[model samples]
Target: MPAERMADFRPDAAADVTDVVCPVTFVKALAALDELEDGRILEIRLNDGEAARNVPLSLKDEGHQVLRLTDNGDGTCALLVRKVSACPVE
Candidate 1:
């Protein structure tokens, strides 16, 4: 999505994992998403390079909807993700 559209998104929760490293970054982000109700959005602030590369893909693999990822221009990035409802078992 465009940056303008991304600016309009109001996340239900936010997490900053810039202080942490790779797997931990994604872990923190996942924990934040877990606290939110399904369909709610989460804004994750993480460092560039590894965290930026891995977090969003990890979220997507877990069935969340990745809305946007934008650079903050300060060696950090913001990732917007929406928690998706789990499919019911038949």
Candidate 2:
């Protein structure tokens, strides 16, 4: 999404994983998203290196919509994601 649009986005929830590493970062982000109903947006605050590269892709692979990923200019980034509902098991 464009920065202008993202500026107006109001997330339903937010999570901070800047203190964690790779898999754990993604895990915490997923847990935050899991707490919300499908279609809700989540703002994830994560570090700028590996977590920045991996978490968004992981969330995309799990069928979530990545709205935006903005750098905070302080070794961290804000990832905006919208949870997508899974298909029914049946």
Q: Judged by TM-score, which candidate is best?
A: 2
Cα lDDT over the full model 1: 0.92
Clashing pairs in 2: none
For model 2, the stretches where C-alpha displacement exceeds 4 angstroms are 1-3, 88-90
TM-score of each: 0.88, 0.90
Residue 90 lDDT in candidate 1: 75
Clashes of 1: 0
TM-score, structure 2 vs. true: 0.90
lDDT of 1 by residue, 1-90 (tens): 666777788899999999999899999998898899999999999999999999999999888999999999999999999999667657
lDDT: worst 10-residue window of model 2: 1-10
Tens-digit lDDT track of model 2 for 1-90: 556777887899999998889899999998999899999999999999899999999999889999899999999999999999777666
Note the clash tally of each candidate.
Answer: 0, 0
lDDT of 2 at 68: 90
Q: Which candidate is the best by lDDT?
A: 2
